[model samples]
Target: MTKFYSLGDSESEQKRLLRQIDLYGDTRGVAFGAANRVVELGCGAGANLWIARQLSEGSYVGVDVRQGQIDAARRRTRDLGIGNAEFQLADAAETGLKAGDFDALFCRCVLIHQPDPRPIVTEAQRLLRPGGRGVFIEPDGPNHYMAPGKEALMKVFHARTHYAYGDGRGSPGAARNLYPLLVNAGFKDVTLTPHVIVATGDDADCCRAFLRHWMEIIAPVADALVAEGLITSRELKQALREAETVKPDLFICHTMWQADATR
Candidate 1:
């Protein structure tokens, strides 16, 4: 089965993800400045690649398993007249990129969808030169929020998504723990930085869009949950109704980390 992260919802979520990436910049200091030659793993739609090419002034390659996304990315790059970026169809856990072929490896909102993120890190380490770094950004599900009527629904929403789709890993708050994983995989000087991107003011529109996107993703399971009495129908209806009226205090603590480890 094509995973939810590789499906249509994620395709639509790309724009919101782009805005978050813009806030974080290309990669961390390790991948910035003199670093060149970059690869984006799970580069859905090529948004990050576009930004990364601009920041690093380097050749950028993006890989994804979805051919649809690769096609979309190609079209976007061509439309934008961006010549330094390219897209390919490849798997995140097993991209056939050459060893030491890239100075930096970038993945955003990708690893959490994997069945095992360790191999993804392992491959990233292999792709990087001795001092090359990997930048990974993921959402901190625990920090996601809702109002009083929707609080319980939000909790269940996150739990079901994390437990079912999170690959038995909590990448959201895994930023700190990834340091050890990188070190164990023979990556040296592994470090992590926690970041939060607030959605406010005119950005409220973006938040509203994101909320709708997530609601669409959760709708199937939510109906099941209500059917099984996991959540009351009345509660679900209230939350759905409130989704429109609630003053959008959209905040996502993107537990992103930039890890630099040498080969």
Candidate 2:
């Protein structure tokens, strides 16, 4: 299993995960209304479930492999006094959920972590009723980059980061492969929608948050990268410092592909 670089139950990490969930949760069109049963796989901290609750009065179930995450999610639900949302501890690929039990299955940034996303796709397919929807959001690894001028800096940063974490052993390019995976899983009307975040001067807060998220992800592996001579400590610090400094000319684009399909 590929370890999650941002793995932790710290308040800061939880806050970051919630911020990320808020950032990417509703970009795709997956309609949720009254009584619509929705399940989110690898639902970290139940942030997406919180979003789903606002959109519908439906019951929401969030599953995660980590008990700490599940506990935090449950606490969040309770703290918010949200009665319709629940969290469970389970593997994304084999959730032990009832087949055809859900009206909609949603996942975000989950597939990229899996070595073989097909199993989770298959599970989603199995869980949804006929004509039910599956909304998956994932990163297109290779396309995550900064524009020219800062290209050299980004290149080294990405190279070291990817070397330590990018390839999930199964499908590093899970976002690009979502359509085929859905089709092969017998889903219909699989539509791919691209959600790109171009962080420039106007998006200063977003840009800072994005870079801080990257900093958190890279921190755990910094020592290893330095030891391997993949990236110097100074170079890593420079990249982080640059990420913090968002200029008008700064162009950083993070693209996430959202694929919606019908079972």
Could you tell me which 10 consecutive residues in candidate 2 have the lowest summed lDDT?
1-10
The runs of at least 3 residues in candidate 2 whose Cα sits more than 4 Å from the true structure, single-residue gaps closed, are: 1-9, 24-30, 55-57, 147-153, 164-170
* Candidates in order: C-alpha RMSD to true structure: 3.9, 2.4
Regions of candidate 1 where Cα sits further than 4 Å from its true position: 1-31, 55-57, 166-173, 199-210, 216-221, 224-230, 248-260
Measured against the true structure, the TM-scores of the candidates, in listed sequence, are 0.78, 0.89
Report the lDDT tens digits of candidate 2 across residue range 1-263.
33553345666777778877556544435557677888999888777755556545578889998888898899888888788887778988889889999988889877877767788889899999998988898877567777545543575556654664455644667888888889998999999889876667667787677767766656666667768777777776677667667776667777889888999
Cα displacement (angstroms), candidate 1, residue 99, comes to 1.1
Judging by lDDT against the true structure, name the best candidate: 2
Per-residue lDDT tens digits for candidate 1, residues 96-212, read: 878889877777767656656788888888888877767766655556655444565575567456644555533545555666777788877666666654444347676566556
Task: List the global CA lDDT of all models.
Answer: 0.64, 0.75
